[model samples]
Target chain A: MKIGYLGPKGTFSEEAVIKYTQGVENCEVVEFNTIPEVINCISNSLCEEAVIPIENSIEGSVNIAVDMLINDANGIMIKGEVIIPISHCLISDAPVEFKDVHCILSHQQAIAQCREYISKKFPNAEIKATDSTAQAVLGVKSKPGVVAIGPERAAVIYGMRIIDRDIQDVKENYTRFLVLSQKDGVVTGKDKTSIVFSVPNVPGSLYNALGVLANKKINMTKIESRPSRKKLGEYVFWVDIEGHREDEIVKSVLEELKGRTDFLKVLGSYPKFK
Target chain B: MKIGYLGPKGTFSEEAVIKYTQGVENCEVVEFNTIPEVINCISNSLCEEAVIPIENSIEGSVNIAVDMLINDANGIMIKGEVIIPISHCLISDAPVEFKDVHCILSHQQAIAQCREYISKKFPNAEIKATDSTAQAVLGVKSKPGVVAIGPERAAVIYGMRIIDRDIQDVKENYTRFLVLSQKDGVVTGKDKTSIVFSVPNVPGSLYNALGVLANKKINMTKIESRPSRKKLGEYVFWVDIEGHREDEIVKSVLEELKGRTDFLKVLGSYPKFK
Candidate 1:
């Protein structure tokens, strides 16, 4: 199967795809610039499946990920999810100390993440914002007085040296990405099913729909609502429950869910991100 | 009041602040590059309140916005929300036809939004990525063969001429922002209250919490869950209800909610973004 990712190479998403498809065989990779483009390619038969970000600083695009999947012309499903810890390093073509660096390069967010470190160490260094952190790592060859902030994997991919590690202020940084495919993943026994549904504009209506899971003692992982956009004061709720769509209880709940709301779209059943 | 925004000027966040504070009195706007820093400023007394993007291509930093708010030391609240329609215009120092363009500049996402237009009309034009669309507009000083894609307000702010309008692939483009302040907004007759709470590791714990709202006949607008991040297999649920916290029914719901959950944090009550 061919796997697609958001990339120009040496990105964290590439690492995520690698980590996810580690044991899977016969995988070819395709890259797309935007989330909608990457997911749209799925329904158009450009590739069998792909990995896209739902939340993460690397992508920092949660809403579009959810919005596109909701509005995509073709049906897309979540197959799996991976949470990649964001570890930014000061990567350089050669080892250098903070004083030796005259310029710094990275994506705007990356630079901002290490803003305190940069201002203290390289107070006069020039800061250049690239299209992506990987772009900064790729462009690090020509500047002797420059260091790029990006994933340590980027340094290895570009054959660069790591000047420092974990330069970002937030040590608990992480990005969660979803594996997208034409159909949801097979029952992993431990899976999460995501669904979108709307209800009448009255009290207890949503509570009634949620009762299906509550009745069966299912653990709900997430529930979010976005404007319906078609009309004023209307909303559509997206939910994540702790069971695959194919699971016995989940299947029965979905069937019952159909009758409880205006419409129900079972987005996908995927393995939870560990 | 002093308001904070993500900026270097001529960006969408600036426009959001302007649009949101249109009828308000005595507002000063301060600019910050990062969401955490901007929100942190509120606690530090750098600014009274701020507008930050929750969703939009211009400020594709939704995760940071949500994450920062959930953990902000200052106990920030959502005072209001505004949805800005994204309308990109091709602007330059002087008007230039598609044929006359030698290069196009904008934030990568803005350029991608107009991807099909460029691929069809200016296939050979050099697509340069800048720190932001505003930076692209600012740098258009000598590049007569260049045009930048950004909000039409950029053209007005930068004194540039717009050569083309609405060249993006999607027409229903909109960015949602939240009005953030130290205290929750006033008791507007029509309001939304947002809260974050957790329940014990029991089957119907979450459902029972919902019962409080249902029993009060509150219309819930949004519900989202995020990892409490403090432990494994634990989550914190963020919810939005249709009535102000001060409202009788909603107040009763919160009082009952306190007894039914692990902990509850009333993020804030704010005027609904209409």
Candidate 2:
């Protein structure tokens, strides 16, 4: 399978794609700068599959990913899942003792992830936000005594030294990535299915829609709402339930759900990773 | 009131802070690099209030804002609210047609907001993501034919000319900003309250908690769940209900909610903006 994902290289998305495509024959990675571009690349047959981060432990939801799936719900299905632990590194050119640095540069998310360490260790240093951790390293490549916090790969790619590592506030910080493809994904014995549905604009609508899953004892792992773009005051709910669509209960639940919701799209079902 | 917010200059946070402090006396805007810094600045008496963008219409929730509020529950309160319409502008060093651009640079959120326009208009151009839309302009400052999509003020600060205006996919795109301060905010007759609560690890816990508001006929504008750092298989909910905490029904609901939840934090209650 040829996999496409968001990157120029050295991004968390690239790492997820790599792990998801492990052991597949003739697996190649295609990188796009934007999430929609990655999805488009697959839709347009530039690649067979795409991997994108849907949520982080610290960041609630990746809205762009949600919007893209909702916007292009026609030919895609969730094929697999991967949750990677996030650990941020501080990279720089010259080794200045962490105290002498004046500005700390990294992605806004990285800046948020490491705020506690940055404030406590270097209270006076100005936090300079960058587009990406890799870009931040590039910005301070020529400057001495400045640090960029990002993935370890970015330091190697940008030829910056890791002055400090594991700076994120939460040690168990993980990002959940979804692998999407043009056709229905292969059903592994152990799997989870994700679907997006929108009920009619009335009271008890959502409750009735969720009732299908409840009747089957299908535990929902995640539930989120995104404004349905076509209309105001209407929303589509993205749901992850603990069963594959191929399962007997799941198939029945989906049938019931489809009847009740105005719009229902089965995004994908993939085996959950450990 | 002396106001501190996140900005170098020309950031959305600056605009929101200005809007919130419009009619206030002695409102001085002090810029900070990060949200935690804004909180710290306010906590240390450096500023009377700090404004931060807590949520965007396009992006679901600003998790950093929620996490910070939860972490500093006792030290801050929601003093005021401002809804600023987010309008993205295409900026470049030299005026040029959108089709001729080789690269389009912007902050991730800006890229997300202008997804439809960029995909439809400049399908072949490379989308380069930057830390801030301001930094994106700075990236292409010396390079011609490189354009950026960001706020108009960013173009002004970077000395870039506006190639196009109001390019966001939705005309009603707005970001909700919250004013945080040590003192309890002045409550206007018409107000809104925000709170965070974690339910008992039981099936009906969430339903019962939400029932308090539903029974009181209080409308909920927003509800989001964030993983609690304390334990595995647990989550905390951030809710924005449409009434002041001091209202009789709201107070009664809070009292009932306190008895049912594992823990509850009344982040703050402040006057809602139109």
Clashing pairs in 1: A223-B223
Which pairs clash (backbone N, Cα, C closer than 3 Å) in model 2? A78-A267, A78-A268, A130-B131, A131-B130, A131-B131
Interface RMSD of 2: 4.6
lDDT of 1 at A85: 79
RMSD of each: 4.7, 4.7
Best candidate, DockQ-wise? 1
Per-residue alpha-carbon lDDT of model 2 for A227-247, expressed as tens digits? 665443356788788778888
Model 2: CAPRI class = incorrect
Q: Grade the docking of candidate 1.
A: acceptable
Task: State each candidate's chain A TM-score.
Answer: 0.78, 0.86
**C-alpha DockQ for predicted model 2:** 0.21
Task: Give model 1 RMSD, 1 decimal.
Answer: 4.7
Candidate 2: share of reference interface contacts reproduced:
0.07
